[model samples]
Target chain A: MTQGRMGASGAPVVSFENVRKVYGHVKAVDGLTMDLRPGETVAFLGPNGAGKSTSLDMLLDLRKPTSGTIRMFGSDPYHAIKAGRVGAMLQSGGLMPEVTVRELVALVTGFHPRPLPVEQTLKRAGIASFAGQRVDKLSGGQTQRVRFALAIVGECDLIVLDEPTAAMDVETRQAFWVNMKAEVAEGRTLLFATHYLEEADQAADRIIVINKGRLLADGTPSQIKARAGAKRISFRLDRIDEPFLLGLPALVNVEIRHDLVQIQSTDSDRTLYALLDAGYRPREIEVSGVGLEQAFIAITAEDDRDGNGTTPGRSDSAGVASYAQH
Target chain B: MNSTLALARAEVRRLGRNKRYSFFSVGLPVVLYLVIAPSARHYHVYGVAYPAYYMIAMASIGAFSGALTGNAQRISQERKDGWIRQLRLTALPANAYVIAKIIASMVITVPSTVLVLLLGRFYGGVHLELWKWFAIGGTIWIGALAFTALAVAIGYRFMPDTVQPIAMFVYFVMSILGGLWFALSGFLAKIGDVLPTYQVTRIGTDLISNQSVPATAYITILAWFAGFVVLAVIAVRATAETV
Candidate 1:
């Protein structure tokens, strides 16, 4: 009823349908299809040259996709942007170096039809103290904060940031998330692109992973790990028979080096109980959720095998589970 | 409309703060005018006194160079720094952006024109009726529009590192060919007659001396203006499409 395809509450805030951007013979973004609902925080997670930036560029109308369409709030990207409904923080663009931070923010705020107060925006971005300083004089983290202030001053409903925290140090990155939490609390829709798995895991409600211009996985952080069946359980054992370990319930893969045995499983508790009931004394057992980094590697590796059928190591059941999770 | 005005004002403020821009575009012209105009004060060429002839010529050089080089350098730098990309993302229309840049370039041309004219009157001992002074100044300013378009085209076409040198070289070549420094004759005169700078300076000199400028000069200048404007549009469109 609400235009194209509607999500849970209503029409999706953003949608891409079979979008393909080809530069020469190389496809920068190939057959991308996704939807982002309003009031949700989503992260596009990809490694370098994985088409994340190209997708963001198309969404912002800065670059036209070679084929297919993209819609923002049920409208074309250009119209949505022109209506001042979308704001963005680009990854590595220069600000006017000569202007003070306050003046630069004020200039950008003036472009929006409904801008927030300059002082309030500055304070919220945690750059109030440096407002009078010229932009060229700021440290890398402070400059990133200023760029953040520029993004939020427009009173936009949807904020898109392409690698917003790439320039920040660890402490600055932490503080940035704190400020971002406050902004997202207003029920605003947020989409960010990042290669940092941890940032995506901690900050995003949903993660959409892409590799080689294709969508590899799409789900909540926990759901992605769960779907990949990549929970890791490691322990030290004096001796363990490899064949017996492979037969453990819910164990997808096993790696044993020296006295350490690491098991990847769908259900770590079941595998641990299996080890105990089997009379294997595994000491110093550590059960940790497979970090998104590992899951990403697994997903991409599976994708590579599926594409070429040359490299073969993953079991059929493990590969089927990953496919079925999508 | 408000957005355009704000952008133009910001550009003007930026130019005001840039000491290098002021020196190269405004200060250097005045110094050149003062140093050169006085030496030729007592001379006459083609029935026009030297002071009046050199005054209008030098003012033309200053105004044309200031508007063209100032706008071109800023555009190339902004393109290099990614400010142009930032602006493209905003709701501000492309035409508005172009207009704001032109307005800013015009604003920069004022001081250089005024300073050169003042030096002509005080230092070179050139005397003209009040209306003629206004007329000559107005002609020089209007003629700068052609160069403004050229600036935009050059800015969008070239990289920041090479833009300044290119702009300087073009200005120098055009100025010499246009006879701003001295009178041209024979083959040189024929080339000078066809150039836009030559026509622009003629418009200014003709106004100050109360001589009617041939209609062809006006037509030629307008034709060059149209051509440069078309080039600027093409350059900007090509940049937008490719990037």
Candidate 2:
């Protein structure tokens, strides 16, 4: 809320302006520029080696950008972190092993000027039962929960989780998100980097896909799906004319095998109507949007094809639509 | 409580929980004293009885070894586990982390120093005045600062697996070279006189014998302490940047 007040003049809660991080010959993060406004639950979706973690490190102030700047709450990342405005759970690694979970959490709580009660933090992180256990003795999932508790104890305005649930079981992951949703309700800006597309599709209001240290796609889930430009309409047709099918409205590509014809269309509704109007009796027709996983692959693959080293996804409508025909 | 003090307290609690630290910081020195002091009790070196001299020697060695290795191992382990990055993400200042380590090392060093002193007084028949006891204990504790810095520098410079062995090797070499094992008399004594470890014991000997400690001893020890501190700062900065 204080961060929101500070952003009254319309500054983003977090911004990266052409930030680049170079490690010798490797450009870990290449000219990354993006912003998260207050209360936006943005997911950083990328494959491994996609610069997601590198970008997160710069945002967390653990690593400095080689060029440009990263601002959190209108100040540098370190200052924001120092002011207790940001909290993070990194992908791997852990707390001090010798101390009990509660003590480690309490120690982190002391680092902040205003922190949530340790009990409440432990409860929210779902580690209250094991709070007395030494950190080194915890299972991988339990250690992650302890780290999550440490992150929330500060009650920071911006919570950055790099694969927060990477080690959790199915049930634990579900419960973690349930608690995460409650935290999000507090209107804090949340940014999480994860390889799990389902997590991004379900948890993020806006998803930014990065690949090879470049932004591949940035939009809402539906927008990204639409940008991917392919919807599937499958049906069993006794007889089909391939040319006629390809000629149908909004049809991009058509595939036929045995009695099954799979239509890849930019607008499945229009394609379906065209199929019906053309007197083709297609039985058991099913329509579905291109899933996030497919979209993610397609987007990154597009970047791979362009290979011209030019920034491709900067323009949302034209850039994505241009690739629709291909 | 301040963040630094809170972190330091946690470090102390960690040291308390660590069985290996307890063994090294308290048990090993006392064991070594018990094993070696009796046979050397009657042998005199440099106008002091060997038991009394060896008592201070074992105390210094144990305290220094514990402080250096303990701090370095903990820091290297933290770095390996990404705890240092976690700390960097918090509001805790970088220097506070270093300072907390120094404090924790000192806290852990105390038990060994005291235990060895008491062992000297009772079993080794070390009959120093009260002021001399205080002075010896105080000198050993202060001398640990150099090792603390050395350990911190090593922690930042090396990986976790190598940190301990490197610290132990440094400690062993310094202890031998500085005459903590036995009193050196010629060129070896000259080399020992220049090292901080030798100066630490020399100052303790001066306290017990009621002799004024030469200014060179203070200068050498302080110089090593300063050099270690600078190395620690540079090493920490280098690791932070590369990380």
Off by over 4 Å in 2: A1-9, A236-259, A275-284, A308-326
Q: Assess candidate 1 and give its lDDT.
A: 0.81
Error of 2 at B61 (Å): 1.1
The deviation in Å at residue A29 for candidate 2 is 1.4
Model 2: CAPRI class:
medium
Error of 2 at A124 (Å): 0.7
Chain A accuracy as TM-score for every candidate: 0.89, 0.89
The residue pairs found clashing in candidate 2 are none
**Candidate 1, residue B32: how far the Cα is off, in Å:** 1.8
Clashing pairs in 1: none
Q: Give the CAPRI rating of model 1.
A: medium
